[model samples]
Target: MAAVRAGWRRGRIELRQSFTNRPELFSHFLWPVLMLVALFFLRHRDFGSTGLLLGTFALPGILGMNAAMGMVSMSQQLTADREDGTLLRAKATPNGMLGYLVGKVVSVAGGLLADLAILLIPALLIVDNLALGSFGGWFTLLWVLALGMVATLPIGAVLGSVFTTARSQGLLQLPVLGLIAISGVFYPITALPDWLEWIGQVFPIYWMGLGMRSALLPDSTVVVEIGDSWRHLETVGVLGVWAVAGLLVAPVVLRRMARRESGSKVAERRERALRRVA
Candidate 1:
C-alpha cells in the first residue's frame, strides 16, 4: 500500500515536471505537429479504388504507433536511471523499485495520453469519416488503447532490463523503427509482401494499429485491411497473449537487473562515460 502510494506521488510529480520542462514540452508537441502536417498533404490522396482517403486510414495507425513508442520511452528512461545511479538509490530503499516502476508507468502512460490528445484534437478536424461521434467508437478506442499499453509497457521494461547502458539503448531504435515501418504505421500492411505481413502480424504494434483503424475508420476502409474484415478478435487475442507473456517475463528480468544494481557498478559506469568523453 505504501509503495503504491509513494509511486503514485512520484509519478504525479514527474508528470508535472515534464509538462513544465521546456525541452520536454517542445518534444511532446513537435512529433505530433509534424505528423499533422504530413496528414494535411495526404488528406486529399486516395488509397487506390478502395475510396478510402490515405490520411483517414493513417490517422488511427499513427495513434497506435505513438502509443507503442511508450515502450521505447520507458526503456530509455530505465537505462538513463541505471546509468545515473537512480536504480542504486532505489535499491537501498525497501520496495523502492516497485515504486519506481509504478511511477514510470504512470508518467510514461500519462505523457503518451497527453501526446495523443495533441494529435487527436487537430486530427479530428482534418480527417473525415472517423467514427469519433459514437459511443461504441469511443468504447472500442478506450479498450484498444488500454490493452495496447498493457501489452507493450512490460515488454519495454524487459528491454530496459536487458540493455546495460544508455548507448546500448540506441541499438533498440533500429529494430523499433523497423517494426514501425512494417507495423502499418505509415501505410497498409496488406500492401506489403506476404512474408513481411506475417512478420508484422507477429508483433503487437500491427494489431494495435489494426485495432485503432477498426475502431475509428469507416467500415468501407475495411477493404484495405486483410480479409476485408477488421479481425477484432485476432487483435484482442494477439495483444492479450503478448500482455501475458510480458507480465510473466518482465518481473523476472527486472528483479535480476535490480539485484545486480550496486554503488560500485554505478561508479564503474560513470568512469567509463567520463573516459569516452575525455
Candidate 2:
C-alpha cells in the first residue's frame, strides 16, 4: 500500500516533468504531427470499391500503432533510468523496485493516452465517416486500447531487461520499424503477399490495428480485411495469449535485472557515457 502510494506520486511527478522538459515536449508532439501530415495527404484517397476514404480507414490503425509504441517508450525509459542511477537508488530501499516499476507503467501509460488525445482530437475534426458517436463503438475502442496496452507493455519491459543499455535499445528500432511496415499501419494487410500476411499476424501490432479498425470504421469497410470480416475473436485470442506470455515472462526478467543493479555499475556507465561525449 505504501509502495503503491509512493509509485503513484512518482508517476505524477515524472509525467509533469515530461510536459515541462523542452526536449520531451518536442518528442511528445513529433509523432502526432507526422501522423496528421500523412493523414492529410491520404484524406481524399479511397480504399478499393468500399467508398471509404484511405485517411478514415487509416486513422484507427494509427491509433493502435501509437498505443503499441507506448511499449517502446517504456523500454527506453527503463534503460535511461538504469543508466542514471535511478534503479540503483530504488534497489537501496525496501520494496522500491516495485514502486519504481509501478511508477514507470503509470507514467508511460499516462503519456501515451495524452499523445493519443493530441492526435485523435485533431483527427476526428479532419476525418470523415467515423463511428465514434455510437456507444458500442466507444466501448469497443476502449477495450481494444486497454487490451493492446496489456499485451505490449510488459513485453517491452522484458526487452528493456534484456538489452541493458540505451545503444542496444536503439538496435530494437529497426525490427520494430520492419514490423510496423508489415503490420499494415499505413496500408492494408490483405494487399501484402500471403507469407507477409502470415508473419504480420504473428505479432500483436497487426491485431491491435485490426481491432481499432473494427471499432472505428464503418461495417462496409470489412471488405478490405482478410476473410471479408472483422476478426474480433482472433484479435482477443492473440492479444490474450500475448498478455499471458508477457505477464509470465516479465516478472522473472525484471526481478533478475533489478537484482544486478548497484551504485558501482551505474557510476561506471556514467563515466563511459561522459568519455564518449568528451
Candidate 3:
C-alpha cells in the first residue's frame, strides 16, 4: 500500500512535469498537428468504391496507433533511465522498482491520453461521418483504449529490459513501423492479400485499429472489414491474451535486468555516451 501510494504520487509528478517542460510540451503537440494536416487533405478523398472518406476511416485507426506507440515510449524511457542509473538507484530502495514502473506507466498512459485528445478534438471538426453522438460509441471507445494500453505497455517493459541502452532501443523502431504498415492504420485490412491480412490479424495492432473503427465508424462502414462484421468478441479475446501474457512475462525479464545493474555499468555507459559526444 505504501509503495502503491508512492508510485502514484511519483507518476503524477512526472506527468505534470512533462506538460510543463518546454521540449516535452513541444513534442506533445508536434505529431498531432502533423496528423491533423494529413487528415485535412485526406478528409474529402473517397476510399475506393466503399463510399467512405479516407480521412474518416483513418482517424480512429490513427488514435489506436498512437495508443499502441505508448509501448515504444515506455521502452525508450526505460533504456534511457537504465543508462543514467535510475534503475540502479531504484533497486537499492525498498519496493523502489515497483514504484518506478508504476510511475512510468502512469506518465506514459497519461501523456497518451492527452495526445489523443489533442488529435481527436480537432479531428472531429475536420473529419465527417463519425458516430460520436451515442453513449455506446463512447463506451466502446473507453474499453478498447483501456484494453489496448494493457495489452501493449507490459510488452514495452519487457522490450526495455532486453535492450539495455538507448542506441539498441533505436533498433526497435523499424519493426514497429513495419507492423503499423500492415496493421491497417491507414488502409483497410480486408483490402490486403490473405497472407498479409492473416499476419496483421495475429497482432494487437490490427485489433486495436479494428476496435477503434467499430467504436467510431457507422455500421454501414462494416462492409470494408473482415466478414463484414465488427467481431467484438475476437477483439476482446486477442487483446486479453496479449494483456495476460505480457503481465506474466514482464516481471521476470525486469527482475533479471535489475539484478545485472551495478554502479560500474552505469559509469561505463556514461563514459561511452561522453565519447560519442566528443
Candidate 4:
C-alpha cells in the first residue's frame, strides 16, 4: 500500500510536469491533429457518418498515427535521462529505479488519456454525425490503447538504452515513419498490395489500428475483413511477445551501454560542446 501510494504520487508529479512544464502531452500530438483536419477538408465526400463504410477509419488513423510520437518520445526521454546522468543517479539510490519506472508509466498513461481526448472531443464537437454510439466498442478501444501502450513502451526504453547518441535517434525515425505508412492506419489494408499488407500484419500498428477501430466505432463501421475483434488473441499475443522481448533485452542493452560509458567519455562529450560554444 505504501509503495503504491508513493508511486501514485510520483506518477502524478511526473504527469503534472509532462502537461504543464514539458508538455510532452501536447507537443507530440498537435501536428497529427492538424493533419487529420486538413485531410478531412480534402475528402469530405469520403469521410461521412453512415453505413459500414462510414467513419471506418477516423479513430484508427488518429490512434495509429500516434504510435510514432509515443515511441519517439520514449526513446528520446530515456536517452536524455542517460545523457544527463539521471539513470546512473537513480541506480545509486535505493528503490530509485523502481520509482523512476513507475513515474514514467504513469506519465505515459496520463498523456495518452489527454491525447485521446484531444482527438475525441474535437471529433464529437466538429463532426456532428460521427459520434460513437456503442458503449461496448468504447471499452474495447480503451483496452487496445492500453495494450498498444504497453507493447510499445518497452521498445522505446530499449532503444533509448541501447543507443547513446541523438544521431542514432534520428536514424531510427525512418522505420517508425515507414511502419505508420504501411500499417493500414490511414487507409484500408486491402487497398495495399498483398505483400505490403502482410508486412503491415507483422507489426503492432496493424493490431493497434484494428483494436482501436473496434472500440471507437460501430460494429458496422469495422473495416477489417479478418481478425478476432473482441478478445483479439492474435493482437494480444503479438503485443505480449513484444513486451516480453523488450523486457528481456532492455536490461542487457542498458548494462552494455553502461559499460561503454566512462567518466572521461562523458567529460569529453561535454567538453566538445563547450569548445564548440566557445
Best by the TM-score measure: 3
Relative to the true structure, candidate 2 reaches a TM of 0.93
Assess the local accuracy of residue 174 in candidate 1 as a C-alpha lDDT between 0 and 100: 85
Top candidate when judged by lDDT against the true structure: 3
Model 3 lDDT, residue 50, Cα: 77
User: Which stretches in model 1 have alpha-carbon errors above 4 Å?
Assistant: none
- Winner on lDDT between 1 and 3 is 3
lDDT of 3 by residue, 62-101 (tens): 8988988999999999999999999998889898888888
Model 4 alpha-carbon miss at residue 74, Å: 0.3
| Local accuracy of candidate 4 as per-residue lDDT tens digits, 1-278 | 45445557877987788777645646747865885585455434454444333333464677667754577777877777776676676566565555565566677667766776776666654443342566665677777777788778767777777667555688777878888888877766777899998998887778788777666555654444453243378878987787778667765666566656666666776676678779
- Give a tens-digit lDDT track for model 1, residues 183-241: 88667798899999999999999998988888888877778789998898998999999
Mark the regions of model 2 whose C-alpha exceeds 4 Å error after superposition.
none
Cα lDDT computed for each candidate against the true fold: 0.89, 0.86, 0.90, 0.67
Rank the models by TM-score, top first. Answer: 3, 1, 2, 4
lDDT of 2 by residue, 1-278 (tens): 89888989999999999999999999889999999999889888987777888899889878987887888888898888888888888878888877887788788888998899899889988888998889988888888888888889888888887776797787877788789889986677998999999999999999989988888898887878899887999999999999899878876777789889888898899999999999
